[model samples]
Target: MCLLLNLFHLDLETLEQSNVDGPYEPMEADATNREHETEQGGTRFSDFIPLDFEEEEAVEEAIRRSLEEETVQVPQESRSIKTLTTEEITGIVKAHSEMVVTEGFRSIIVSRRNVWTSAIRQFRRPRFVESTDMLYVTFASDKNSTEDAEDLGGPRREFFRLLVKAIFQESGAFEESPNGFIPRLSVSHVQNRVYRTIGQMMSTIIVQGGECPALLSSVVLDYLLTGRMFDIRVSPEDVADLELRDSLKTIDQATTDDDLQRAIESCESWRYQIEGLPNPVTMDNKDAFVKNAIIFHVLLQRKSCYDQLAEGLECYELLPLLKENLPLRVLLEMPKVRSDLTADVVATLLKPSYSVLGSNKRPKEELMVVKFRDFLNSVQEREVEECLHGRTLTEAEKTFLRTLNPGHILAFVTGSSRVPAVGFQPSPKLSFVHNENKYLPVAHTCSNELEIFVNSKNLADNDEFEYNFLVALMNGANFSAV
Candidate 1:
């Protein structure tokens, strides 16, 4: 019986330790075998017993709790990560070598060509033949260098050749590298060469259908003499005169390489002379000659020349000359003449009584009134004020308004008002005044009625005063009928 019981107990322990799903059946079998052995030669087998329901339940609950605990926590080994060094990172980048290319070279060459073209064109006429010829030679040098480079095949060689040729054709110039010497060419020389070649190729067309060379000659002479091209309004007769055309043809015939080179030097000398000429239109001395020239250019509708003249006039010390010669738009656009100054000037001009005093107060007012009247008349004739009023306020005006606060509104009203008002006065001493008290609410009904009566009855002779009084009342002034 003791043997059977020990055997049964061992089977139950094995069943609990094993992962088999039918541990109970295996336990029963083991128990039965042990019982048979006991019946054969031992005492009772009832001593060997299975687990009770309470013990089974406790075992299952313990297993469930163990699983929950395992799920809630993560193993420390699984959370660890590895890091890479700078050398390792560089190696990864190097392994991906397909990312870079030779496109940057082409972009650089294209940009160089664009800058070269713009600089050359700025002169209008080719004025540096030697430099231009050098540019052509440089292009040839580049082409030869590229051809030689093609012989040594590489990834970027063919593209380089194409680029060199494209730049050469576009610039009408070439580069050459001979015996380890790099030579560059100028764009002016190339343009002159191209023009001469074109002229020679189709002389008959120029002689027959083309406009006379006299026109070009006049343009050149005008540029030389006055630093200006002939106006676009030049009549055909001006160019077709036999003497002028013949003279022009003589100059045109002299368009050989050497002559063109001399002409370039002459043109440069002329440019230097113009630049060196004492700008009489400067701030120190407002030259009448320059002012007249500006007016003439303005009349001629030469915007570029006019703008240059205006720029020169900006340096003149005479405020009157500056004011008179400069276009309103140009004056307004000046960096030094800010919105405050402009508004002040415009506001002063708009007011009938405001005078720009210059030591002599009595004459100054008269002078101002006369000038203002004249200005008003001219502006009215041109409808300038209407046009300006209709236009939107510029950034400068917005900024001025921000700084001036409520003062700008007063100025705008005073300046833009028709049936011109008297000068703006902060107090009732003037015909039109700013009433601060009017901006406050009335305390009594009779005060409000008095305000209304004052507004309705224009007892003041000055229309501006009545208008301003009404404006003041509307803005919440206290008044009484008495």
Candidate 2:
């Protein structure tokens, strides 16, 4: 497939000289002959894999079955029960009533701006985890339209990307560490049950769409699953307090007794914080003191905050899913949270759809698809010179291609700048714009489809096509802000 794709390359020199840039005037006889050929089914682009109705239905059913299979069944004996106070019970009941109102709807609707609140609200609904309904995302542009068409996959992908970014901000419940993000104690947030809201949102994104919150500390995750800190390794960098962190770092680096003594003396200034340090510590027990300090600061001090996060995570029964799916569980705590999105990786995920072989639109559609492939290969290979492989690109075209990072292309189509932990469910489809008058590309994120204008007479007419595509991407792919 790649070999065939390589056959079609754009020559900017040739494109510049072509008369196709002038207004297209199709001869009546040619149009009639092309239509007759299409009616007779002369030829078809069989290589392009279109997501037909049957394939789409199969995808839905497979997702439904997996949703049912993944829900954790907690044993009644092991489940913890807390006696809620009158105020707590009343709040719980009231929240449940509000969530119940959305039960009849098959999908939750979220917009780019309101992703956090919408996710928190919809995720709290009892059936969000258990129900097999897919997630749908609505765009700000869709307000005036009257149609049932919404999320196919693009909007949902965009929604998760948006939601995840908002959840992991520095001021939020989690803090960055060398290991990954660890939960931080926020008194007001905990009092408001914000941890639980985040927990529910995480589980829903994973269960509903396979988007994992890959930014979490392994140690924190292990504790969440097992309810015990096992093999805890807290480095100086992990300490949130700068003074304490420097003290521990100094103690760890001390080579001489005098150096060790000085570091220990500095720690003595905050002797009250050293939970189990021996008074007047010597070199013999300095290691123990350092270890204790690490434990006290990293685990003991923040245990309450971590505990609340665990409460929310377990509330939606995400523990079992993580426990059972070892690879996915491992992904959550991985230090490198995102996959390195490359051009080839993005190209492989695209499945182009074509009209019938003999149709009048087929030739133009096929060329557009090839041009798109050329764009991917050019980006992937990073051809910095004016010429790509053997073909030449004008300076403007080269600059445009250089500006398009693979992630931007992926997000423009899939709605997330980073590939989802589970990968795009139904690979993004490439289709042609039905209206030749429209030169720009349009992305239907819900369906994971990118529709490109294909009226360009041949490879020569691509300068305008490329320009229009860039305009569409810059205007429509407003993803960088998040």
In candidate 2, how many clashes are counted?
Answer: 7
The best candidate by lDDT is 2
Off by over 4 Å in 1: 1-339, 342-407, 414-430, 433-482
Q: How many clashing pairs does model 1 include? A: 25
Question: In candidate 1, what are the lDDT values of residues 333-382, reduced to their tens digit?
Answer: 11111111122233232333332456344353444334323433333243
Candidate 2 per-residue lDDT, tens place, 273-361, comes to: 44456666667776777776766666655665665566566533555655543333532454332333456545555666889889988
* Candidate 1 TM-score over all chains jointly: 0.14
TM-score of each: 0.14, 0.65
RMSD of each candidate?
49.0, 21.1
Q: State the displacement of the C-alpha of residue 336, model 1, in Å, after optimal TM-score superposition.
A: 5.0
Q: Single out the weakest 10-residue window by summed lDDT for candidate 2.
A: 44-53
